[model samples]
Target: MSTVFASPSENGQTSGATGGASTSAASTPRRSAVAAVTNRLASPQTINFVDVPAQEYYSTNVFTKSVMKDRLPKSVYKSLVRTIDSGEKLDPEIADIVASAIKDWAMEKGATHYAHIFYPLTGATAEKHDSFLSPTADGSTLSEFSGKQLCQGEPDGSSFPSGGIRVTSQARGYTIWDVTSPAYILENPNGTTLCIPTAFVSWTGEALDKKTPVLRSMQALNKHAQRVLKVFGHTDGAFVASTAGPEQEYFLIDRNFYYARPDLLNAGRTLFGAKPPKGQEFDDHYFGAIPERVLAFMCEAERELFKLGIPVKTRHNEVAPGQFEVAPVFESANVAADHQQQMMLTLRKIAEKYGMACLLHEKPFAGVNGSGKHVNWSLGSSSQGNLLDPGDTPHDNAKFLVFCAAIIRAVYKHQDLMRAVVASAGNDHRLGANEAPPAIISIFLGDQLTDIFEQIKGGGANSSLPSGTLEVGVDVLPPLPKDAGDRNRTSPFAFTGNRFEFRAVGSNQSISGPLVAMNTIIAESVDFCAGRLEDALANDPDSLNSAVQSLLSEIVGECSAIIFNGDGYSEEWHREAAERGLLNLKTTADALPHLASPENTQMFAKYGVLSARELHSRLETYQEQYCMTVDVEANLAVNIARTMIFPAAIRYQNELASTCANLKVVGFEFDTETLDTVTALVKSLQDGIATLEYAIADDSAVAPEDACRHRCDAVLPSMLSLRETVDKLELIIADDIWPLPTYQEMLFIK
Candidate 1:
């Protein structure tokens, strides 16, 4: 049987199946998408660049040390600065003075209310606003913001997902200000509000938010890292801290196209999109010229971020069309996490104003590169800067070698924990897809470091590789200094000169969870190393260098299996990893169960990062999230297939039948091939929809793990089957009569 595939035109117009002119009777969505493109193209938009430098407006809205010093008393400023810089406990007496100063500053900025902002388990920021007004006895209002209000807030916790932390009857939760992260003024056209970063906890003192565990992990890491610094004979009474810089990636689509698709709106991804004819195949989009409108939106978003103390430093076009990336300067992990949330918010808000919708979904469109947040992490101190940096002579830099060895051991010991932290419903769609890293966690140490470690494991390393110079072929170009080694983009955890970049984190996920896991695991490794060094030094005080060398050699030999310099996306790597006894958890359901393992529980508990009960609660919550996400997507596929796609296909089928019948009446026999194809596809779609409905309606009581399995094993496959038939119908039906927007229109039109 000969088949005709009704491919869409460049502008989304379809050729009629009956060998006649295309009809425009049912092209509402397509017409709308086209109009949006035309309108945006005709009217170019530009941002009004400010005359002042960005440095002038940097941290203007933030309550930073400079602002506090200018506003508060000298004594109060000293005390607060000590608490912030030295990790000293806050003084209660300074709270009222600071609150008074903050209220005055906010009132001067035309503020009427203040909000205690916290990150909830829903992976979104939550806030509760309270007016800074109190009625006097004489019926007149007085501006009032007390120390108690500044420090704590009460929000109803019953509605938030607690995973058994807070029962229904126990609806009380408290938000305490996290002084480590500075407060900022969120500006609006009508009014401005003071946004204070905080940590949420239940009445029973259990951590009910992501910030608490992150703060605890920071403390644990700081304690052990300080011990290591002291052992290295570098004790300057400076506090050690972990720093992070997260690179965010996302897609931009026209608002009209976004609103027309229910799947994109509800599931944050397209449930039924056929592969477009052109899709990032030429690799021309990576670092290509930025579109005018997208650049404008990025500029305005960066302006907002700069005013709020987020040092957004880089922006560029990504590997996929309509996809882009932005990165900020490094800061403390706690503050960087807060800044990342604000960056996402700013991207979305500015996109709306520019007639677009920012998509942070890991895989919003299929058959293309997805989004990921590469978190650059490191440890540093005021006294000993950048412990991870391997200077010119890495073999002689014993301190740096010891720290690098600790990282390798940590990754080898807690690979499951690293995977568990980044596991989520959205991430499962991106990992091991040839674009992002594989599900198995591995470290990428460049040639220099890898060779040094190999030498150490074999015996001793007395020399290091020299930096080479790249000589350009042309006389006009000058020779440049080459890096010690080439970068490995395929590695999930890669050493990039002075820091490690975790490339497996999802675009839409908060960085706090991954940071917490990393810090806690490293703390364990550092503590173990410090104990060994102390014991060795006690045995032979004069042979300190020999003892350090021996310890590092042992660690390198044990943990060298996780260091890979090859492609992580290769199938051979997957087989080799399994042979090496590494875990390849391919899905959120497969990975989240590791959070409750005995080793993980004991590790977190020993490091004071999380209790067993808290860990269990987190695992349950994540599993439930995965199950619900799959359930929602399955139902949406069934609903759209039945209500929208099937009707369009049937309408076209009737048109084909009517045309054939009229042709027959006129004594002209018509070909039945087009009608037969449509008829068969429609029947298949109906059958697939029925099977999906049955799968969704199973409604049996089961464990969370079992529910996740049911959703993945049964419901997801059924939904895919339905999508296959529906997508096939999309290609065959008349584009004028197709109800949904085509992939070409959504992806290329922008």
Candidate 2:
């Protein structure tokens, strides 16, 4: 059991973690110093991280003293580096030296305070700020940060969600330094603080933070991957690693509209908006010119990301009107997860500066394309490079084929686990909606590979595809360009050249959860293959190629059910998937329990990815998260329907009645049609609101999980019905009489 805090309720009681009511710099001299650094970067044209020289800045590698230069002795610096990079325990003797060095660096950069930054399972980072002011014996104040302070901090654990792991009375929790993620200085109008990334754990030692499990899972995969590499005679290898490049998609709405919508403010999604008249229908905004405001926000956000060592590589307008995407260059899974958390934080802060609110909620608006994070994954041996990439002669590369077949086998065997990885209350609205991949998990290998596989299964083709490659005078197209394989966007897990893109992951969800599942499952597959090869080599070293071929043949035959190279959104593919026996676990309730299934438990335990207790604990946690989310949304819908929509409709009805009476008294006969429409809509709104209220109350009367399902399937529908009637009222009601912003105003406002 790891001692990390898992949710917000676990640490909410912690004092000084939320930052002392955001103090301004005018109160202290340190604030003035920090402002100078921030002021320089505030100018848009002067901010440039792309050309920032690495020599004078902090390096990504933690084992070097370049980041802590001019602060510590040679011996103390090396000792701290060892503790940070090699997982060595921090020495007490070097504590003062290290602390003094950090304080000096931060002060030089104009920082006056510091905070222990930790991820507390609220799907975001948390920090309780503190000033660096300490009283000296002579009465003068001294800014101090001790070695112990740098390495550890205590945060009250009872307030964060511990999945019933601990009670409020037992609230002691500790934050330990996460040396892998570098500490950075954060500047604010109030003051500057050196934020150190740390892992939060409970007193009882159950894993509490998201990063802990991710780190553990990474270690698990590395061990198994190394074993597999050893079987392939890679003797010099110390590690085999996995990398991820997550393409994040999101929507940006004006902050004014965002503030006006209670649903968006409370739930991070709008539960009551009618579809915009021109919602992505014209196929515009996709890769269109970036809005000036959005462009400025992106520049600042990217600069912050770069300073923090997040390699953001690409940005573009997404499919929907307000939608956008940012893709980072590939990094190790652990670093990638850290960077993602930081990136979201940067986006939130910077978007505010541009008067926009970043919506990470999977379906912020109904009928518009929701967000998703396409996780591009690949594995490589320390000695062997990427095993997924085929060389020039792919047909003859048995190693690459074997690795590819292993992934196919893994995806086939644990398709449920893969589906469960991205299952969430928010994502339920996006999956199988034609914009994203279907709920059914299937691999899409392009046409060229499809043909190659078919040929291999059928004992190789008699006629081959162009035996020799050639150059062309018109070099717009590369000679042969490797096979022009057909692409499949429908499959949840698709092989795209050198890596597999897991497109089923939702944008707002943490990649660590899915990567943990992927790394564990793939490691299991790799272990299985290595075992078979080891035995075969021992039996007959002379027939190595034949053994490899036979192994791949068996894998391909068994895992063929998991492959589909057609449209995922098509009804035909769903039926075909059903016929081929694929599990379509659509909802979180349907998918989460599978994590505790006997087979999944065994597979995870086999590779030491997660113990059965840990797996069961997480399953329970996910179920709870799903239920709580639905319950909150259900409550929000009820409130909006009753308070916002119901009152708005009544006002409109009153206006209509007043107008009708005035016309009748004047002997000018008014149309009864509009009056009748208003009356009927009011009645419908009353009925639908009553229905929603009944469903919400009844759902609360049942088991928590059942209540959640009721909210999704029953309560949600009633809310939508009520919303539909109210929306009709909006279309008919005079613009001056309507209370809330209309869809057109909310969606089109810059």
Candidate 3:
């Protein structure tokens, strides 16, 4: 945390790598050897959590029937289990029994309080902690909870952002029981609390929360998926479910450094700083050794997540300095989203315990790799299972081919809608970047399947997927086998081994938005295919395979434009996509309006994913959110310029001018060139500020969209230019006068 600067000798050589007298005077007391060893042991290490026996992990890890069996009666336990697995309505009579069981289980785990956890439109989870205390008639107290309290909660809705759905005057909002997601105990520094996942809604109940729409979308998908499965000649089975494995990427900066930057604290990104002298250019940071501080945070985070029943599968260094990624195994979509939310909060709390701040911003630092949440999604049935799985005999698996073709068609036809799912003010900095996918949404089927789809289109037979060994070109390397195909990182939606990885979601966003769109779109396509096949079978009473083939053939033809097997980053692909009539929305403003488009409105309405009114309201909400974010950032830039940047520049200019004057008076010639350069730069910055100020004040004259565009695309660029000039001044100025922490200090601390 010390602002220690390197010193230089009179000969312009760096003073010997020893601490200067001034630096030594400023140093704090040294840590004990025991403390240092403790710090070293905190670094991340493999836990072999996945290798735990299934019987022990699955049976004892989570709140399963075995745990509930000892606490509740047979009837109540069965009812709760049915509700959790089958998505049935929660029976009010069973709430007290279930709550009591949960309370006992949590208390055994050292929990003293309970919280009703819910997801609001703020893009994060909200919870209110309350102690489980009930006063008795005597001088004693007994902890107790009633059926009504367990089933419902009334939290103050006035504080949460409602997107105009809930006005402040209407303070009534309800948190209804979402029995599908399991309740777990959150262990904190002070004490532990029972966290129950619930769906929040307003008095009017127009889907005022993220979880509500996700559940509704899941149901809509189930209805259509059931119809599709029925057409495939199946009945008397459980409903279809969607699964997601969201790979989370984030940055961990030392708490001392992060706290020093106002921009990081307020906006979750660095507003002004020159690029670091060394960045990710050499690509050495990827899979690099975990820094001691960051490693400790990750290890503790993983352990906590495991205890909460979140299966943390992978952890590694990412493509940039201070960037890291944590990926969990796939779970049902709703459960996965809930776990993701839980994981984020857990990461933050654990990071603080390690004296670090975990940044979930899409672009915390400019000129380095930005973070993205890769949503790996797929459909799985309760009985027949895995609709997207192309079996060993893929050509004969009519159901798989039909479902796969449905996803392609859905993505191709609704690329804009897909883009709309991940569009956000923060993510505008990531999409189309070197490390992130392009704004154009294209499906990467890999080389093997691209050829297969082409053959299917041309009425040709499927090719042999010959398995082969992959060898490294070095003698020391061992031979490795190759799979069906490789993935394309540049593609917005790429099909990995088992799931479609939607790579455009922002790090800070909830996975619910994108998965909802994906599930609904897939459901709609499946419904369309089912109706077609049912009609054909009824009319001809003949081959189901031929009927499915015809349906898939037509779908692939209509939506073939969205399929891209080559490099999506290449300019050639963009041009080809343009020619194929694909929609490429490069920014939040460009993509958000598509949410209310007639095509999207019709699709959602047909599938009952969202009503027309709800769709329009969401679009408006996003637009308003985008505008407000830009406004806040623009205002921050203005404040920094006026208070911090401008004053520092003027002080430096005065110092240079004084030095030149002193040299002239002392009968020695001094170059005034540096002084003149500083003067010119200051003038340019002043002019840029004036321009931004005028545009900001003219906001009343133009529309909100225009104003937002002016701020984001216009004023933002000008602000960057202004900062460039000021940053140059900082490099020349004395270190003592530089008020803000340098980029090196901010990025490299600890």
Candidate 4:
């Protein structure tokens, strides 16, 4: 009930938050936390999906290709299809027709405003909304959307985090509409906005946003993939595209508990809490029956997503209490990235209406499984089908092996780059823990594929790995397919039957960063394969099979160090991985500098995914974000501990001393055990708080590396040590007087 001190990490981030200056919560009308959590229908959201079949509502909000066909002129529709299907440039003359069709479709969906949405460097979505109204000479308005307005919009580059790309007095960043990602109406209770996904860039044409690099990388990948397909005798192929299906995991707690804890409100995590008496220890929470309240939220969330054309297919309980996951089916990389950002936004907003807060931080709590976004990715073309799949025919299988070999080569050569892409302050808390993958980047080929690759290294793969079925003894349960082997959850990157799952991405991050890196690296590797095979065909046309085998063997022989089929969580694997020369970057600070390394920058520049200047700008911006996050966490720890925990502990200490004195006067023996324990923890808490304050103040400069090193070495240890003391106090202190919500109440009450 007392005024909580500053939560300076995005302080005042949530509504009615207490800041550096104290403010009272006692006056606010808050029901008992226990009663508030149990009220299942406290914030009822009326959505009935039972009657509305998915077929009727799915993609109804989007300006689908079907709608385009119905409205667009035949020539215009055909031109648009060529651009969408083949990655060809949109014909400028057809822009007016396309714009008019999209406007009509969106207007029919009840959209009055349109937004050019772009993903900027701040790791968040950006949008500038404009009314569809144009003033008439008679002072009335008419709905209008011009080809120029639909194609490009100007947003101030200097206002955003462009690193050094934009200086003062420069306000020129262009958001060019990306035709590949179709426009959709984003639904809001008040109104709907027509959202056009676009690529953001500086005036000089540098890639200034996340979407731009991803688009460029996709183009690079398609060009290189085409070169390889040409060598395989597919003269005319549809443009190949890497696809992504990001499985988002998150935790949801009641709104009362979420707002009560300043740490949770501003930082997206509980900075302080004792380990609960019960946790995910029993493993009962994993795949457990969904809580009724949570099930309703999921149902509504998925229904909203379906309307927007996001194909969410699975929803289930995850490994920790209150943790859950939702996975969408795969889509082209750019669309997937855009949908992923939308999905995060939708999940958080919908949770609020259901009276819960969706926690997307990688590690929202301690001593439990954290969250990760497992990105299932693959590359293929409509003409060639999925190149990663081991097809039924021998020739198809051989082509698959070549593409698979390219991925292996890419991962092995650029392990550091892979690690660097997923690096973030929130993720550093989860990686290398038992719940998530280790920092060392490696490939899991499964048993069957591993055997084939081993045989390729020996000489050639003479046969295919046969698939089998699992025979359950019970007659009621049907046989299950024995997949290429059981999946290795600990592997950072694992190749499933048809795609590789990048499990290192944090739950809160956009999938764009990882997809860009994956597409670019694989693009370079495919180019390498095509050059070698092209030379072989030039020399001897009849020896095509021999050339393919030779290329696979060469890749396997050299890049075998990256292929690990064992338990990736084992201590033995860490030592073995080190011996194998894989780079194990344990922290975001350690990994981010690699983004600006000459090799990485050169690769980005070579593929036209990003210029050197663009790459450097990204590196600078991300490093700044990393350092800022650490500094914020450190400061919050010091402020919360000194102001909240220390005072509460002292009050209890006073009460204990008074009780012992009063009992002595009443002629009774007072057991000093409780008193002594509280006294010692309070003193230790004070000492720890002091240590953290000193650490934070000492290294307050802006140098990215030193600042980060100080955080990792000094501030983080002090914060952890302080948390240990505070957590002990939490166990001993009276519940009525404790300042923050307990983990048990936050994690289990609902």
The TM-score leader among the candidates is: 1
| Position 725, candidate 4: lDDT | 93
Supply the TM-score for candidate 2.
0.86
Candidate 1 wrongly placed segments (more than 4 Å): 1-25, 41-47, 699-701
Q: Is candidate 2 or candidate 3 better by TM-score?
A: 3
lDDT tens per residue, model 4, 584-609: 89998899888778998999999999
Residue-wise C-alpha lDDT for candidate 3, range 193-293, written one tens digit per residue: 88888988778766667888788888877877777788877885576788899999999875545555667777888777777688889899899898766
Residue pair clashes in candidate 4: none
Tens-place lDDT per residue, model 1, 1-750, is 211111123224321111122335554665655554554432333334555777888898999999999999999999998877767888889889999999999889888999999998888999999999889999999999988899999997767888898877889999998888999999997999999999998898888898999889888988888877777787786767889999999999877678778899899999998888888999998999988767777878998999999999999999988899999989989999999999999999888766678999999998899999999999888778888989999989988988889989999999998999899878988999999999999999999998899889889897777779997799999889988889999999999999999999999999999999999999999998888888888888776788788999889878888999999999999999998888899988788889889999999999888899888988888889988898889889988898889888999999999999999999999999999999999999999999999999985848888888787788888987998898888888887777776778777775
Candidate order by lDDT, highest to lowest?
1, 4, 3, 2
The per-prediction CA RMSD against the true structure, in angstroms, equals 5.8, 8.9, 6.0, 4.8
**Per-residue alpha-carbon lDDT of candidate 2 for residues 522-641, written as tens digits (9 for 90 to 100):** 878877887788789889877667777788778877888887888899999889888998998877777777777899999777766666765776776777788677768768777776
lDDT score, candidate 2: 0.74
